[model samples]
Target: MGRKAKFNEGVIVRKGPGKKAKKTERSNFSKKLDSQHQKHRARKRLQKIKERQDKQKLLSEKKKKLDRIQRKELSKKQTEEESEVESEEDESEEIKILPSKGYSDDNKLWLKPKQKWIVQNENINDDESDDNGEGDSDTEDDHDDVNNEVEDEEEESDDDIEMENGKEELDDEEDSNLKVENLNDLSDDDSDDQDEFDSENEKSDKDVDDLLPIEKQNIKLKKKQAKDQKLADEEMQLNIANQEVFQFPIKESEEEIQSLQDVQQRIREVIAVLTDFKKLRDKTHSRSEYLDILKKDLCTYYSYNEYLMEKFMQLFPHSELLEFLEASEVQRPLTIRTNSLKTRRRDLAQALINRGVNLDPIGKWSKVGLVVYSSQVPMGATPEYLAGHYIIQGASSLLPVMALAPQENERILDMSAAPGGKASHIAAVMKNTGVLFANDINKDRIKAVVGNFHRLGVVNSVITCMDGRKYPDVLKGFDRALLDAPCTGTGVVAKDQSVKTSKDQQDIQRCYNLQRQLLLATIDCVNAKSATGGYIVYSTCSVLPEENEWVIDFALKKRNVKLVDTGLEFGTEGFTSYRQFRFHPTMKLTRRFYPHTHNMDGFFVAKLKKFSNLIPKSADHDEVTEENVENEKK
Candidate 1:
């Protein structure tokens, strides 16, 4: 060591290499570990955590014991006689254990457990307690009691917020003997500390036991009673917390949440409770108590997070939110479009009708569309379908092509066309006369487009697999274009339930960014002035304002394009302004369809006329804007 030090006295020393960690040490679990081994490790980990919690509890109890002893000593020095008299009075007071109505000796009012006052156990006897497996009957009883109250005559007056059925001071008709103490300190903070608190109280009780005569030997019985009382208190506190926060919120102003996990009118009832909590809730309950119940209910019923629920709440009115959620739970009606290039609509309808399919013309606005009410044969596998008479699609899917109004013998671009539903619709409208470029980024998806084109007998279309955003670099100057942009699938939750919990704000942002880029590319690909068409119909199967209005507004600012009517009929007008974002007054020309209102998948379609071909050099979509959105149409 001395010789090495002499070699470089002023040189800085280098750090040794990091020690290698085993897979078990570095990661939570190893792939090599079997299921049984993993479960054993988890049990051991939980045991260690429990030991630590017990140690902390003992330490806290020791500190509390020391403080209590000191307080007793100080009190004795001030008033020894007063302390004796208080103990005598406490000894005289009896702990009468009642399993039923909680009336006092003189028949005073009882303060029920605010959260679970409605739930009661008619058979909570000694035998039931011995079994320890009959507790579910209690909750079942509570459900029946709440249901009865909900079905009773509606509350006309705003007075009884605490569920009093004309009983002078009683909070609820169902009551027990959970000592009617102060209801104000009903916080869920110390529910887990009941054991520690009970131990401390029992120690003090033992001191009183030592002073009593030997003839009165019911000390053990008293201890058992004390333990039972503490158990009831702990159980009551847990009932107040996460036992389906929606369970009680199920009971609302008009109806209880009921089978909906309080989901049905649960939305309307929650809205009513939230809007007027002061009139709906008791004086002791906080506003968060109601909201937490609503959030938990929404999560359980819809499989969405609290953040997404808040976003939906902000977008729709309190009443509309209910309709929207209920609609998402149900399936959308089935519809299909006739391939004009392959067969006539009347001929196809007659053939399908003869095959035991119950269907009707979609609407007066669409001649080639049919709404299928019932189909005995598989709609996708029928002979007419294989011959390509109609393509299975949603009713809302027809709007964008109708808006585009593709003409025969004109060049057209389907910027994001995949699976060729809309692209084939476009080709059929043109009667296979024009050159149609059906481009999609995904190669696998374009296969479906090609298959549809061939089966539908669409002769005048070309397919390419390239990113839609790069279209301006590869191709340009089309007579008309359609960008059915990829989106968060917010409007189609009824079809794909996974979207309920899977989507969030980041998904929304990602979709909006992509839509803005693709829409701009679509405008760039279309000619400013064409004899037949100079339009781009932008669309998505999404209802969010961010993915719909926000993307269109951003494109308007970047490209020389103006909004035009979708040209068919019957859809809610797009918002000219939303939250802090504003668009030109003509933004109303865009159309919006909803599952609840239109009985279709949530959708949006906007037709824009390109006025010039010049594109802005640089524009960022990340900026948060707060522009004027005043006097928006209802």
Candidate 2:
């Protein structure tokens, strides 16, 4: 039909255009090569996976075998030791019970029943005394000590009186030899002097006898006072010396540096300096210089980056910053929220108490909260937990849901709900009467909500996985919205200490930008004209103002919403102005909870009442997004 092939090297061309050229197709060789390459890759991938799994299995089995051998050896050793103890017991004579004085049976008398004074109250101190069987012995010993002291004093007084009487007799004989009829007037004068001396000596003797017992007590009191004064003086001197240490005291400055190279003592010295800068730090150094060194020491000690330390110092006053840092290191109380849908708080607490769970109601501020001080059973694996009677949640997590105040039959949306804490709370508050859409971006995170919702029997929840920024397109017009945005987790450092060194300024900036975007989307998604409620609760586990106040301020100008009280009974009022940044005066309506002050995670909650759906022109954000929405739809 057409001219055949051109003779150019390995190129065949259809020269005539009689028929439309067919689309070029891969050669059989190339197709076969691609199939072979794909098969090779798949096989290689499977082989690598199998090898890794095999290695893990081998390691695990080896570890189990070693553990089993160790356990058997330990059991054998324990049994041998126990058997040795039993054989020794069999060979030894019967043990005799000794008296409270630790008396042996070398010359023991016949046994007789003895009386012990019964304690009327079960005070711990009294119980300890009774347990040692020394209650009566201690009292008798005290009485004996007093009697001995009195007897010793009486013996000394009697010896002194006899010595004085002998001295007077010798003096009288000497006077009788000297004065006779040699001088009659001298005798009268000498006799009068002797009578006066005798009268004074008798008066002194009478006073000594009267005050003999009390004098010993006075001496003992004086000794005790002297010891106490010495201790006080030593403490004062030590404090002064501590104040005079160079930078800080850790053996020597060089040794201190060497000690600091080790983590064990570095943190100790760092905390000491932070707690008592005036006393623990060198007096020669200026406060500013001390703080500079302290900042570095704190970073090294607590494993924090410099930026986060500066951020906290800026947030709190100089004195409270250490408190906040210390609080971050301590664990928050293990708290659980009772599920009212299934059980009452009283009944649930009773059931847990019966199972040897040491618990108490959390505080007056909460009706459904319980704090678990100790537990014989794992918190998450308890029968009551499996039965869905309660949830182990942070006390701070309860605040956002409380602030949102979800009502019955009202549509609610948890824009970033995962693990379903706040969402379940909202569902319970609504009594499962209203629809709740719990959406999170991560599919893996959404899986957690599934377990919680099922366990808690939450019926009115629709779990969705999508970007919160794109929430408005699929689900619009929520009666109320809760945005517990992802944050730097500054408030929950106690729960996750890795946040200290892992976070940076860039992280804060990234979180700030994300929070702003999410807050705008949250406000836009809520139905401002709802009859019952048009509230949005914005909260974060971060105490940073950039993630909290600044973001809230941004929303205030961009959306038609005003700040309102959270209705929570307690929390520090949000900062109206921090450092150089000033926020709306009504920012006080927002609440802050801190670990140091409130004994909870550092949290911020703000309730905003949306009056209208219209956004401000200053928010070119909505305008641009709206145009994009139209373009995408078209």
Candidate 3:
């Protein structure tokens, strides 16, 4: 139907000689396939067999490891149980060592066997080697014997026993093969062990001497050790007690060293001004003969061979100043006291130069003068002073005398004048014609003032060492007076920086009291204007308000003295009081001349006049203006 299906029915059914050939080919092919399948099956069987053998080998190794672990665990448990028993025995032995009625001390003696065991344990680690060069093999044999005994025991499962037997047999075979070698090694090892045991016994016997009797020997040893330790500890404690805590010396840098050297140099220079080598040597030589002159002289004066004058001379032997160091010479410095009334500023300058005393006019107070340091001659010892050319006054100190404006023959009092500086100047203003009563509380200083008066050829002067407060009670009819009170000298710190460090509140309070006392003393000296119409100048070298303006206010409250403005055309106004003038050291023309500014001393001055009328003039009694005051609080 489908194109006759290619007419294959009879062809497909054809069997005959072709059928026999096909059957033979088919049988050959079947044989070939069977051979291939057999080869594959053979390979699978070989692989399975190899895997089984490997698994058996692995199981055998695992079983051996587990057996070894069980044996070790058993041995560890046995050792721990043995340790507990030994510890309990040791405790019992310790309890037995306690003091008994028969024993005088709590000590015990060890039995010989006990002693030997303790000593052996102390000195040696556990010994694993038996008497052997064959020790390892012997241990293996012992293990195998134990395994065989374990196998013989009826307690184990049948399987375990069989495994144990198998292990024992394996070990026995190994032992048999090594028996002859082991016997020889064992014999050698036993001989060595005998020698070792004898040697160990001898060592133990020798060591026992160090541990003879546990009771007495250990107690004495422990006591001795305790004493030694106590002594050592005591010595250590003593050392700690005696040791001084040390501080490192601060190392100064070059600049600091230089600064210290400079300070020392300045100190030496200042000290030199206070001593004369010639006078010292004269006093020494005149006092004694046959004495160690140099050493004794040093010991008597400085107690060290470092007196400023001597040190300077030693350093500068050939210096021109050496002449002044000679015993016969007298070295003195010049002093210039200004005369504002008579000598004009320019005329005074020329007059001083003509007199061969170098003079320089101080600023603002052209009336005040200074002797030039360049001129080596001593102006104090000059003939001009004898002839009343000048009074050796401080440059800043001349401000008050100028501010006071005393007339010719006007009676003036210098309340605190010592060595007669301003008093002599006041006398010069009066042309040595008016009476000037110069008073100082220090009697020792009166001689100095007298000497100054004599040198200056001053005539209208009287020097007294009475308290200034008693001046009104004694004799007081003066046109003017100066109360140069003592102060804390804070303003002078620039000239001497040490003052800056030295000042404190305590010092200021102390100075405050002193200033008040001095002011009171001065107030007592000034006469009411109706009586001599006198005035007073209050002054100090202090910058503190308590010693300056406050002191003035305190004086005014207690006395009839009226504050007077200096009317100085040059310098600035003073503190709060318009009448009083302030000269700050830092300013150009102030009464204070600080080292940083004018290289001069610090000073303060206030001028006042006693009102003659009962009721003071409103203009004269003007309150201080706010602009004149330093608004910042002190």
Give the alpha carbon lDDT tens digit for every residue of 1-634 in model 1. Answer: 4545487778899976555642335556546756888899999999989977876675566557556655654564346334334543433322232332422222223222111232233444443233222223333343353333222111211112212221221222124533333445533433223334335344322233222233124655666799999999999998977444232432453253347643645655666767776666555667777666666667767778777787787778767887988898889888999888878889999999999999999899999999999999999999999999989998888989999998889999998888899999998888889799999999899999989989999889889988887788998879999999999888998888888778887777767877877887889899997877889999999888888988888888888989887896899999987777777788888999988998999999999998887765553532422111111111
Q: Which candidate number would show the highest TM-score if scored against the true structure?
A: 2
- Top lDDT: which candidate number? 2
C-alpha RMSD of candidate 1: 30.1
**lDDT score for residue 378 of model 1:** 96
Report the Cα lDDT for candidate 1: 0.71
Q: TM-score for model 2?
A: 0.65
The lDDT per prediction is 0.71, 0.75, 0.51
Full ranking by TM-score:
2, 1, 3
Count of clashing residue pairs in every prediction: 3, 0, 5
RMSD of each: 30.1, 36.6, 33.9
Instruction: State the displacement of the C-alpha of residue 569, model 3, in Å, after optimal TM-score superposition.
Output: 3.0
The residue pairs in collision within model 1 are: 250-257, 257-262, 260-263
Off by over 4 Å in 2: 1-153, 176-219, 234-256, 261-291, 619-634
Clashing residue pairs, backbone N/CA/C < 3 A, model 3: 334-379, 334-380, 337-391, 574-581, 574-582
Give stretches of model 1 more than 4 Å off: 1-268, 275-292, 618-634
